[model samples]
Target: MTATYQELRRSDLPSLRREIRAGHYAKHTAGLGPGFLQTNLAIMPEAFALDFMRFCQRNPKPCPLVGVSDTGNPMMVTLGADIDIRTDVPAYNIYENGKLTGSREDITDIWTDDLVAFALGCSFTFERALEEAGIPQWHIDHDTTVPMFRSNIETVPAGPFSGKTVVSLRFIAPERLDEVIAISRRFPLAHGAPLHWGDPEKIGITDLGAPEWGDPCEIEEDKIPVFWACGVTPQVAIERAGIPLCITHKPGHMLITDIAEDAEVPVRNPRAA
Candidate 1:
């Protein structure tokens, strides 16, 4: 008999995360888990959960919260049936005094009783939706990580969680911009709409080739640079939040789950084409 998990082309996400957790794979999770939801992970102490939740609520554009684990628990039962918060993500960064000190594949050895995990919806999930909608993603096409940058735009504060919004940049042709906008808005759980287009410097980006995170993509003359609120925004916030200790999924390595992608609902944007 064929394994049920193996039968899924890109849909067998839980097993994928499990393999990633066990050190079977460590690479960018861009095109994997076609129909399932993938998220950014941020683990901090329960002491700051309320403020962080409010930070997400107040600044939904950059910090759309998708799932939260109970204090001291490594299980993210709500996000996936057997999700283990500490080991499910492909890679993790440990921070101390707001500085990244180390990286890990799993955090079970260091997991503490007071830690809480937050899973924020990521654009990878919606990008899969966009592909299904017949929109092309240039970064994927060029085999490069999506470009990201820190913006001049400030996020609403909740306690210590505050900073300028960081965004992932994509270049799309003029003919497809309208359709991209329409498809993205349907996934509000993820960063719903783009923040800016055309000029990167208008958002404090000095150079398109030099990115704060991820690999840079080459832009063609016919394509324009477009920016969207990214899940990495929380990493910037966690830095500003000044938490003595925190952990987050390394950029591009996400936590994939069992959500359907083709089930996207049509969303009409009044101001968008």
Candidate 2:
């Protein structure tokens, strides 16, 4: 049976994690676990860990590091009590020499002693906040993943990681834009506030109907598109870097952590203020 967002949202974290680990759920985790924090996953060889860590540190907006596992260990203690990086996420993208090879439900076969796992904050956390604040998410309303695009803004580079920023779009009624921004600003770990709103072209996005990732959402006549820095920014950087091998959660398919969405996250970048 297909699980509705409401059903999954009310489901316990342990059960959801178990279902995801068993490969029974591979769908985008938008409204699932309504008040729990969700994250983007990145796993790479230990040889590239330092450089990737530096990359995340430099590009904090799009790659806010929430949890990092010890080399070769799948347990992300900081994020959850029993979260296993190897099978926690619903899907994983496999990359080789900077190209996408395939996707898998589990990467235990490729898991090696020299690999490191990273968990980056995702905007889904703030989407719930928006909903709680009375701002409806059009994508979630229509049961679609949020639209994401590659933007014109460039990320600060670190080692082999460098690429244009990627952002997720959500249409907001003009009158409520300020309220949405205010609600989002509270979640600094979740790409705090809007990066750009009103014009997509100003950010080099040529078409609102076409998104680089996820389903295209309807932009009602009264609404304007608002953009937020996306966790996929690191995936773009990883692909461009052409690292020997890399793995990340397939876009939209995130790792749902046990942490509460409203839990206070220390500001890793004050400039976001």
Candidate 3:
């Protein structure tokens, strides 16, 4: 049952996961499953679970806590009935001693009893809300990853986890800024509203054309740059921790959950074109 990208965008949660689990999709999950909740994955050893939870608590803007898996279990019952931490996401980043070892579609080979999975609320959830409100997302429209940058702001330390916050960028028309902020504010689990808009330099982001992760977005004279607390902020902390092992969903490669905020929205298959 092969489905085109346009088909998958309108697919039900289960059908999409089937494709992802089969290793058929391993890319940024921005426009797909637009109304449902999405999570940034962070699987850490049992020993670091408590501290990581605290870290999320201290920095809810970037690390909004959504669902947490049992210490040894791969299933995320809190997020969805069928969410398997190992194979559900589009891609996984494997780290050893705080270094990125590799990235792959599945982590079943390394699944262990001591690993605990965390589902951090992602801004992808809000991007859909923005689009629904008629706010444009340049990166999604261009089929590119949203640019992410590190800000000078520091997160409150939780055990050994502490670092500057990361932010996801989008350029939206100046006239739509207030309306977009209102729409995005509705999803607390999705990082809830822009942290800052306009001048990127105010946030300590010196370079607008270059980004620390994801693709650089083209500047538009009409649209102002908007920044939102990014779920990838945790990955920076994970890397700085130097833990023996850590696994995270690659930036923008999120785990889609069944929790729908806008299920009533109708989807059309653009492949009909």
Candidate 4:
């Protein structure tokens, strides 16, 4: 069956993951999964799970630990119903020994018994909330990838997982800056709030038009550049760790979950059913 964006948007948790795992649809999930949780994915070897978890604990801004699968299991049942780590995301990036090897729609070939999956909450969820609040993201409106830059900010070091924090940039009207920050801070799991605003160079971003990942958005005359911690920071960290093998979702392509918007950001560690 053909899966339309509108159809995907309203699907319950198990149904959405099933559709993604089927491999027929592969597209940026920017505006879909309304009022639901969408996540950034990282699958790593068991050897690095403890250190990576510590890294997330120390650096909550860039690595808000949402859910972690049991060692060697791709099933993220804790996050929602029927969530599979293998093929639930739209796309996947495979890295070998600190270098990007290739990307795939599914990683059944590389699936191993030593792999552990981690799901990080994404700013996309908050961006959706902002839109619902009547504040639109320029990247979403322009149909472009959100601009991301490697910031000078360093994440707290943990074992082999330590690197510069990457941030997503958005251009917003000065009048809406207060509102944007205020609303975003409510969703702490979704990168919760902005790390910096106004000057890009202060954060080591030299060019606003050229992004390290994804497409760039225009900074209008009336709008000022705003930045938020991105979940992609782990991709950079995995490269630094120089692990033998790692897998992540492609930029803009994310794993949409069954958790409703209100349930997306965890209020407490509710045990998986």
lDDT of 2 by residue, 1-273 (tens): 545566666787778888888777888899886777789988999999999999999988899888888998988877877788999898899999999999998999999999999999899989988887788898888878899999999999999999999999998999999999899888777888889998889999999899999999886778988999999999999999999999999999999887777667722222211
Q: What's the TM-score of each model vs. the native? A: 0.90, 0.94, 0.93, 0.93
Per-residue accuracy of model 4 over 1-273 as CA lDDT, tens digit each: 757766776775556666778986677788877766678988888888899899999999988888888887778877765677788898999999999988889988789889999888888888887888888788888766798999999999999999999999988889889999998887777888899999899999999888999997776767888999999999999999999988999999987765554553553223323
Runs off by more than 4 Å, candidate 2:
1-6, 266-273
Model 1, position 198, has a per-residue lDDT of: 90
**By the TM-score metric, which is better: model 2 or model 4?**
2
Per-model lDDT:
0.79, 0.87, 0.86, 0.84
Residues 130-214, candidate 1, lDDT per residue (tens digit)?
A: 7787778877776567888999999999999999999998888899898888888878776887989998889999998889899
Which residue pairs overlap in candidate 4's backbone? 13-258
lDDT of model 2 at position 149: 98
Residues 42-161, candidate 3: write the lDDT tens digits. Answer: 999999999999999999999988888898999987667677899999889999999999999889999999999999888888787777677778888888889999998799999989
Give candidate 4 regions above 4 Å deviation: 1-7, 10-15, 263-273
Q: Indicate the TM-score of model 1.
A: 0.90
Which residue pairs come into collision in candidate 2?
none
Of candidate 2, the 10-residue stretch with the lowest lDDT total is: 264-273
Note the clash tally of each candidate. 0, 0, 0, 1
**Candidate 3: misplaced stretches above 4 Å?**
1-3, 262-273
